[model samples]
Target: MQNSYPNRQWIYVKRPEGRVGPEHYELREEVLVGNLAANEVIVRASIISVDPYIRIQQHERNTYDVPHPLGIVQRAGVVGQVVASASPLFAEGDWVSTYSGWQLYARCHHSELTKLDPSVAPVSTALGVLGMPGRTAWFGLMDAGRPRPGDTLVVSGAAGAVGSLVAQFGKRAGCRVVGIAGGPDKCKFLTDTLKLDEAVDYRAYSTLESLSDAIQAATGGVDVYFDNVGGRVTDAVIPLIKRRARIVICGAISQYDGGLDKPDLGPRFLQHMLFQRATIQGILARDFINRMDEMVATVAPWVRSGELHFHETYVDGFDELPAALNSLFDGRNLGKLLVRV
Candidate 1:
């Protein structure tokens, strides 16, 4: 390794207004001139996740790590291999994944990482199915939503990373699965690929009325609804929920474009929960990390046996991460979105 390194990164250009575009972020190049400190290691990124939180925050508001101010490198989760190490557990050739955000190389404290076991799980799994998004699905379904046999489970953004896995996991628990997505291809994926009991295309339906009608037909009535996209989708389904239903608020990709606004039939739906004795809870997966081993155990065998399916769209190269993520916001990709470093 060289004594000095040059790293290229994506920087926040300005605070976004409404619909975010390329102009919101700027690709900046910087030179890194350093060596590892005693408890630190240097890693070259292998894969990075293009997630919603990166776009939701202002140039000054970060979700996982600290925010990246305007004209500065952005923060995101990354999977990498250590090229040089000064820590006891991490050594040269060690492969691990972390919350490095969006950068080509990382110099971080060794205590901040867990060594990746390539023999047990594929390296890319750290970014998608076997990692954060997968964990989010597992934690949300089991703890918050708690679907059971014969229960009707509905997941919004059903073809997405967290949504796809949540639907599959709910299926494994013996609940009937219904998915909602933006396009026909994604709708097909929920049925043909993920094998959920039913799928609804939000675009074809147009209004909240049609979407509610389609979901009503699929679920009969949902016992649990895993909400990833908020806006109209939530408005469409909330009133149709079964008595004593549970709603897990995961990510609101729908509302992230702009914070909450008055809804079409918004004020009317909260009474449905009260009348039916249902529960609605918002979740952040990190709150359940202590159960990581349990999540791994729950999904690992299914992953190996091909019983549980994880779908991801990979865009190679460190440079391709952002645009790949933009595709997600535009509903252009299905399943989990991943970047191959």
Candidate 2:
């Protein structure tokens, strides 16, 4: 390997007001001083994730994650190969997953990384199906939503990384799974590829009433609602929830583009929850970190055997991170969006 190279990184330049753009981040380069401490390793990033949560994290007022500061390497989930190691836990050429951000290379402690076994699945799966997104779907749906046999499960943003797996898990549990996505192609993939029982095209319906009508027809009434997109989709699904329904709030991608400042004028759907005695819960994968191994054991086999399906949209180059993230809000990406570094 070369002694050193320019470490290109995307730095947070400004707090986004409404929609995030390339202007919010700046690509900067610095010399990577190739040196390691006793417990440190230098990793060359292969893939970096660009997720909706990153937008929320960049906001000035955020609850889920620490607000991103300006002039810092933009934090993200990454899969990379260890190029140099000073720790016994890792060796040169070992694949690992970590929060190494949007940089081409990272220097991290051995303890901070999870070694990836390429024999189990592709290393890129560590950032998508087998990594945080997969864990989010597993714990959020199974633990929080808790769909049962004969139940009707409905997922918003069902073509997305977390929602896609949530739909599959619901199906595996014998629930009638219905997915909601933006375009016809995504809706088709949800049904044809993901094997969902039904797919709802949200873009086809111009009004909430129409959307609700379509959802109501698809699955009599949702017994488990795994919500990824909030706003109108949530509004449409609210009234259709059956008695004793479980609503899992995994993400609110629809509201991210507008930021948290814009007041939501939607009806008080909490009233519906009170009447139906439904359960609503918000989930974060980090909260269930201890159970990740169990999740991998359960889901990995299905993935390996071709029972579980995963899709990824790869935007090549380290500088494309901004455009990759923006694609999420526009519903341009059909699956987990990653930047190939």
Candidate 3:
């Protein structure tokens, strides 16, 4: 067996001013020796994930967690296969998911890995629908949004990863689901593919008032708002809340560029909360990590029987990691954005 293997990694080198792309990362190659401590395994990355939260962590100041420290492999989730192992729990050719970031190869302790069974679902789904995004969508909507039968649920960033799932789940809960996305193509996906009741294209309207009007027309009045792209879209959704509405703050991809450090405040929709007696909650996937088995058990059956649809936008090659992440902000992806390594 080879004692060492050549590996490629994307290192976060610089903070972004507006948009995060190749300029902020450094791609370097190194050799990894096969020596491992007890309970350690070497895995070769097969798929890597690019998520919006990565940009949030890039902010200089802390938000939900501390800022991502500079000069490290850009943090991400990876689905890979074990090539060598020193742990009883893992073996060569076993598939696993790990927080091994942007590296093509990583030596990880068995504890840091979650063994994946290809027979269950696609291993790449570990980085997507069956993974963090799924957890966020499930808990954020069911627990926080609390959609009921015949309720109007409005989802921003509806064509994207978490938003798409939230829209479908809202439909499953017997709600009237309206999806708000960037362009006509994504809107089409929301209505035609995901089968949402209505799909609004936020980009068509140049002002908040116009966007708000569009959403109001589609939803009539919102009983639940699942927000992923904040800013103007959020401003638009707030006033449309019906009595006892619930708002689940899942993400704010619109402001992730630089607004987290210096926010751009919008309309004071807090008055809407007062009028409607609505509940607003900010949910993170980490909060529901303990209940992962509950989510998988409930949602995995839908995945296996094709009762749920998972759309994946794949960017071929590990080298496309930074670019794929940047494309997220541009609304270039349909569902989960992934890099096939």
Candidate 4:
């Protein structure tokens, strides 16, 4: 029965020069041409996650994952329902999550998918809080930042998917959390909704001196810095780092769009790191996949009990994936961004 429906997919067409647009992708509709193999199951997408990392994946060559090939579906994490199955592992109507990309239906072996239970939380969360973003926050904080009680923890891109959770984790660990976000509204959401100790609007300050002053006013100095959006915000925060500070480089969204060839040259801050005895480390979620169960055990309760609040910006339709992705670089998304198909 599922074979009767046309499959629509967004295929990568060209390498994005700077910011990716709809022109970089080609949406093609093709009829399902064959039956599922014995080990395969077919999934109908319900929600597709549009992330900043996808922009990096658009390059013809990348170190993070295999570079997407031309005319192939754009890769992304998706939450969907099984509609047809030759695999005994997944029956029709079961919810699953996979790296199936921007497509209406995906047929893959059962090993490629993770089963999700909607009864525990919204299945969409499999692509958000209870999924990679949440795990990124948990492991990156615990492993890289290593917050101590009463320590001043600061996070850039604080209103974002990973950054918001990192702020909450700091609060839970008895640290004073300060968030740096784009605008006044996002800054408000960080303080009022996410309950960070302080929030700084990076957009409000034009110079590094003024930004540093705001950080100094907030928590005196930062002991741990969870950096999601690097560049100017990082430059400002470096001057205010306390002794023996730990800086976790998670995602540099500020540089992901266009600065690959000619990188932003900023003031040399290695001296500050040397004098402060601060340590900086770059982290990838894939490195800590084994600890995902530990993260879920810790964060799932907070989510279920309403202690940890998560926000999501939903854009309807698969065609909006490019626009939804572009929103991340534009600071248009409040939290985890998703496209409901």
Candidate 5:
């Protein structure tokens, strides 16, 4: 082993007014001197996640939480191997997951690391299916969506990570699933691979009225709406809820750029909720962090057995982190988007 390791990091330098891009970040390289305190471990990042929430946090205004403090490493989920450790629980060459952000290497405390067993599933899954995205989809759907047999479940952003899992979970719950995504290829993925009962391509319709009609045509009425994308897509789904419908707001990717700061309050559809006695609730992954085992126990088996489909789009190289995050708004990724370190 070398006495020092080369480390590179993407620092979040500026907040974006509209779309996020490379301009918002600064990449710096340094040599990490091998000096570890007791119970400390140094892990070399192999995979890094670029998610929508990172964009949301960039906004000066608070959404789910306060804005991410600038001039620091872009915070994210990373899967890596321990290169050096003074901790008794971890050793050299052990795979682990940590919230160590967009850095080639991280020095973390023993408790900050989650030891991963690669034999159970691919270590990469710790950032995808069996990780935060999986947890978000599981609890967000089952708890907040409260799907039942024979119910009609409509999922927006259905081709993406959390949305895709919610769609499948709805299917497993015996609900007829209708997925809404942009583009034809993602729509086909929703129907052919995810086996959703119907897949509506929002991009096919230029107007909200047309999109609403398409959604209504596919689903007579929505008993449960698992919404991941807000803006026009959400506007279409809101008015289609059935009696006693449950709406789970997992995300609003369309608004993450600038809409969050100055939201466009579109046409009013709360009357639909009033007529149907529908309930709308917002959920976050952190809310269910305590019950992570419950989510893993149920979802991990299906993942390991190949019963559940977890698609991931990987961008090669650490330099692509900012670009990968920016690409999320363009709807370029079919599922969880990650950067290979």
Candidate 6:
């Protein structure tokens, strides 16, 4: 047993069944026995992020999985408190952000956990609104989606973690944002709460014709489509784009379960891209490395001013990880999902 501390962690156990299951992950408790090297910090996790994209990385994976050898705790960025430090930048009680995965304790090099500005935003926001997801929203819209003022922006996964913030940012930039979500509650939250120009329930309109009609009625033509869950939804949106439209391919959570044999789109879709002079891109948020400090500076004020709003779904127990992760992919989470460690 650890003399003064208990060490515990969750590791990816087996290739998931279809998507993921409790059996896919195994949490083991052990004694804390480690020494921090110079310029390292020991972080006792405060909140753990449970994101939908985590579903895709169980085995040999392309795209987001990125060859992270299996058996490590699933990769997730976390916010935590410094329990011990070996560098001048951090001391006890400091809060920081790092890709610490789903574990109770994380030992990180000093630079791994970026010191959070206490006056700017909540520490939890570092994992959501003021963090990667937020920057994902900010850059994806401006860089790939390219929502010009008065242009119509369509966002899928439109009420979940990244989508909600994207919608708000689109509105602030003077674009009319239309949202497409999986169900009625999400639709309501997006349209009624976030005040999107229109919100379509993907469940209500099963056919492409009806879904297109809903989009057509919303803003006449889509100037930008921010895709989160791919497959049919994207196939449907491809035909409805206006000239010079931009499609931001962020994540395809829908296809993670369906595997690599995802549905192929019509040949005419590629022809449309050429004919309309459109653009499509896959964004990894880390690519905007040069602008992170500036991005945080810009968004932090909005968060502090309450111009930006964030909702987090909290699961109270560390052992409830599987269920919490289930809530993420199933659209049970309204905004960000965090396991309170």
Worst 10 residues of 1 by lDDT: 258-267
Per-residue CA lDDT of candidate 1, range 141-196, in tens? 98999888999999999988899999998888999999999888988888998889
Q: Give the TM-score of each candidate.
A: 0.93, 0.98, 0.98, 0.97, 0.98, 0.94
lDDT of 2 at 197: 93
Score each candidate by Cα lDDT: 0.81, 0.90, 0.93, 0.89, 0.93, 0.81
User: Model 2 scores what on Cα lDDT?
Assistant: 0.90
User: What's the residue-level lDDT of 317 in candidate 1?
Assistant: 76
Candidate 5 weakest ten by summed lDDT = 1-10
Candidate 3, 1-341: lDDT as tens digits: 35687999999989897899999999999999989889999999999999999999998877888988889999999999999899999999999999999998999999999999999999988988899999999999999998899999999999999999999999999999999998999999999999999999999999988989999999899999999988999998999899999999999999999888888988787888999999999999999999999999999999999989999999999888898899999987899999998
Instruction: Give model 1's clash tally.
Output: 3
Kindly report which residue pairs in candidate 5 clash with one another.
Answer: none
Tens digits of per-residue lDDT for model 2, 38-128: 8989999999998888888887875687688788998999999998888899999999999989899888999999999998999999988
* Candidate 3 clash pair list: none
The per-residue C-alpha lDDT of model 4 at residue 44 equals 90
| Alpha-carbon runs more than 4 Å astray in model 3 | none
RMSD of each: 2.3, 1.3, 1.0, 1.3, 1.1, 2.1
Task: Supply the global lDDT for candidate 5.
Answer: 0.93
Q: Per-residue CA lDDT of candidate 4, range 94-189, in tens? A: 999999999998888999999998888889888888999999999999899999999999999999999988999899999999999999999999
Instruction: Name the candidate, 2 or 5, with the larger TM-score value.
Output: 5
What C-alpha root-mean-square deviation, in Å, does candidate 4 show against the real structure?
A: 1.3
Clashes of each: 3, 0, 0, 0, 0, 0
